[model samples]
Target: MQELEEILRAHAARYPAMEAADYVKLIYQNEFGGCPAAARDGEKERAVPPAGGPLCEPIGGGLCRVHLAALPQGAGPALDRLALATAREAAGSRERFLQKLELLRGLCAAGQLPLDSAALEAFLAQGGAAGPCPPHSGAYQAAYAPGYRVLRQSYADMLPAFLEAERVAARGGVLALDGRCASGKSTLAELIGRVYGCPVFHLDDYFLPPELRTPERFAQPGGNVHYERFEQEILRPFTGGGEVVFRAFDCHAMAMRPPVTVPTAPFAVAEGCYALHPSLRGYYAGAVFLTHTPEKQRQRLMARSPKMLERFEKEWIPLEERYFSACGVEQFCGVTVDTTDLF
Candidate 1:
């Protein structure tokens, strides 16, 4: 633990974004190289699983045998102490027990313990209620919330169009990122902004006020958003290179919040449902429409905001369908992307 602390203190600048658990992994890997060099690529993959044996494809980065326990510690550290408690009981005899001991000692001969301790400390610090479980018991996703899990995906498909738009919109222009609900449009837009060096506008911020949610208004395609206000305050000014200040409608408070003045930028990503609406179409330099299966969208909506499902089914989904179909939003976009193609 002291050695781990020393390294953390010495190299803290190197791993500015690395969490405590990741540091522990470096120690463990340096010491054990858990998945041996030769075992990594083909030999293990070629071996067939025994009939009826269970198989699991772990996502994200691979874990070591120590982390195989699925300790809430994550990819942090795999220590001998944990192994002793976890594995010593399974050893059939003294020789087997000594062999496991030797393995641990040999692996920890350097400074792998750093990985082990930092991970544990971070886990405890994060309010993870640690508990003991039998070895080989499955690691549960319920151990953490979905928000804690990172969504990784390639920008290869969207990059070309995005870069082209950035070039075209060098002075200023709108890139409309429209998509199916819960299809990750917002996250994708943010990623685009990071790479393209632009700002992102979430049209969700201009949701229709309670007063505007009348039956007749709801009947109109894409009538849910207060697009009139959005266009005047956000779309128009941003696309036209004017001084811009806009207020985000507070859904919970059912009122408009204070306005924020946006600085001028080379490009802007307008992301959300109805971002490419017929009324706002001319404001965009380019648009990307994201698609997803209804089942997958429902699954995401259920996990993301369970309470919104009833409203989405009864009102929002139908409204979006009418809007997308009548306006030909999918066809209108310059690029079409499937959510499954990414993470």
Candidate 2:
């Protein structure tokens, strides 16, 4: 294990702020893998301890493969979404193995790490297996009480929303997520709710009905949504700390569903297009505006039906843009995330 020691030593030099205990945790993860977690999207995720401080911070956007395995099996839909997204963002284990191998080669080339790289490759080539955790694994488990399961995710795209959620939760206030269609507002909102244990309220549920689609209403920027009902139902009761009861407008059925009651929590999330409209933006303690390049936006939209993409390109996207430009949605919000490159 001399090579392992050399790897640790080099990692310590690169990330001096990492404590000994964290190193042990990282080694444990490297050897035995992370704890199992599941996401609402049916992806299996793994959670790892936050390994290093700022200099070598493991959070943020990258091609690196990592995951959050700490979230419990039944941590609710919001958290499950986060776990799913986290898993989707992570590179596959095989990819991670290649990345580590490349990293080792790079370190050795730079004279920063000393080890028999060829020997490591030979061991893997010879079908050497890592573990079902040997008996001594209990010692490390004992040292790091409560086991290796802790909820921490390292996706780069999640940092801003995560921090904003923490800030809003500290004040027991609401956070808003507004963005271009398919810009990942809902996904990020779910991640924030999972991390902060907050309730999420989607603007999609308050969609406008056929009866309200008057030309005058369509002409007004940000009038596409049933904001009047939102202000009366979600907004009023939410600010008052009472149960929020409102019927979701079903776009498919073109009608309102049965009344849904949501319990008020210390923090809550409001996410979707038009969520940061001028009338509602003021009520939020914090807000995140998600955006991406036109090319990336279209790429994401490819997942939907061609007719739907046509409608978005012709009708809905333009409407949302007008509102965003008219209301300065990005300027009003405290954070803006350009998700063009991030998953």
Candidate 3:
């Protein structure tokens, strides 16, 4: 967890700009950006062949061809931010209309691809139709009469996890995201920042210095970090609107690097393991604990480190479990996001 956190930040700062391929990879990891093969109509539960799936795999659990065609394209990006807020609302013709309205409004808000408002207004006016979008609805066909949004079966499927963080942030609150290593906390953090236009601080920047890495400190749960320096340098100063600056420690060099300024923003998000330490918990307005099953956690780790299976089994896994349990971090969090159920 410690090394992973450090590397995530270092890479983000090192390559601030992502290429086109990077954009596709990152966006697709979210439910909205990927293919919608997983969606099907409630009225029809016909099984689909594996080769007929969205990405040409056995994905679509059961999708009728008509409903599959009714599923809108491009609208996926628009509904990415709205699906959760709409979940609790009553579902019916009225709910369906509002959902589509929200989608278009989001599209308008984003200044993205075109949406025919007049056509959309008339389409939604008649109450949504089942099956394929009725003719004359313009480009966004299935968007007219929407059902449940299809999730692209990815980490972004956990958009609901950060929805609460967004709510807190909207009210000028600070959010601290702490979770198991490789549980997609950083990915969610980046998604929230992009959507809300907020600045994020990574706890990995405050890694323990070489001098602080003594064996005695390692014995204590999560004592491996320099929370004191992190407090003086980041949390308190940034929250209080004081001069905010801190040096990102270079683990490879075993030394602190040059100073980095914390930009002023309405909402500041701190994300990483041990982010919700008991002593530091009070500083954050909202604390989120992300969790995942050991199986999925190992799969994610193995995806990146094919050769580190043994290392993770013997070293990192135990270390994370010890810290999570010993510090009572789970009990202290405002939310516990389980990533195992996303798929």
For candidate 2, the TM-score is 0.65
Superposing all C-alpha atoms, what RMSD in Å does each candidate have to the true structure? 16.0, 9.8, 15.9
lDDT per residue for candidate 3 within 92-123, as digits (tens), equals 24344334346444543454323334543454
Most lDDT-accurate candidate: 2
Give the lDDT of residue 66 in candidate 2.
26
Number of the candidate with higher lDDT, 2 or 3: 2
In model 1, where is the ten-residue run with the lowest total lDDT?
144-153
lDDT of 1 at 177: 86
Q: List where candidate 3 sits over 4 angstroms from the true fold.
A: 1-156, 341-343
Q: Which candidate has the top score in TM-score?
A: 2
lDDT of 2 at 268: 91
Model 1 clashing residue pairs (backbone): 24-115
Q: Model 1, 1-343: lDDT tens per residue?
A: 3343344444333323434333333333223332222222111212332223222211212222221222223211112222222222232243432343344333334444333444454553663312121111012112211111111113333433444455456546888888788877887787676655677889899899988989998887888899999899988887777768999999999988998998877678889998987899998888888888888888888988999899998878888889999889999987777875444
The lowest-lDDT stretch of 10 consecutive residues in candidate 2 is 55-64
> For candidate 2, lDDT tens digit of each residue in 72-185?
343334333433445444443644444544555555456554435564455446443242112212333333222122123333446556656666776887899999998898
Please give the TM-score that candidate 3 achieves against the real structure. 0.58
Candidate models: Cα lDDT each: 0.56, 0.63, 0.56
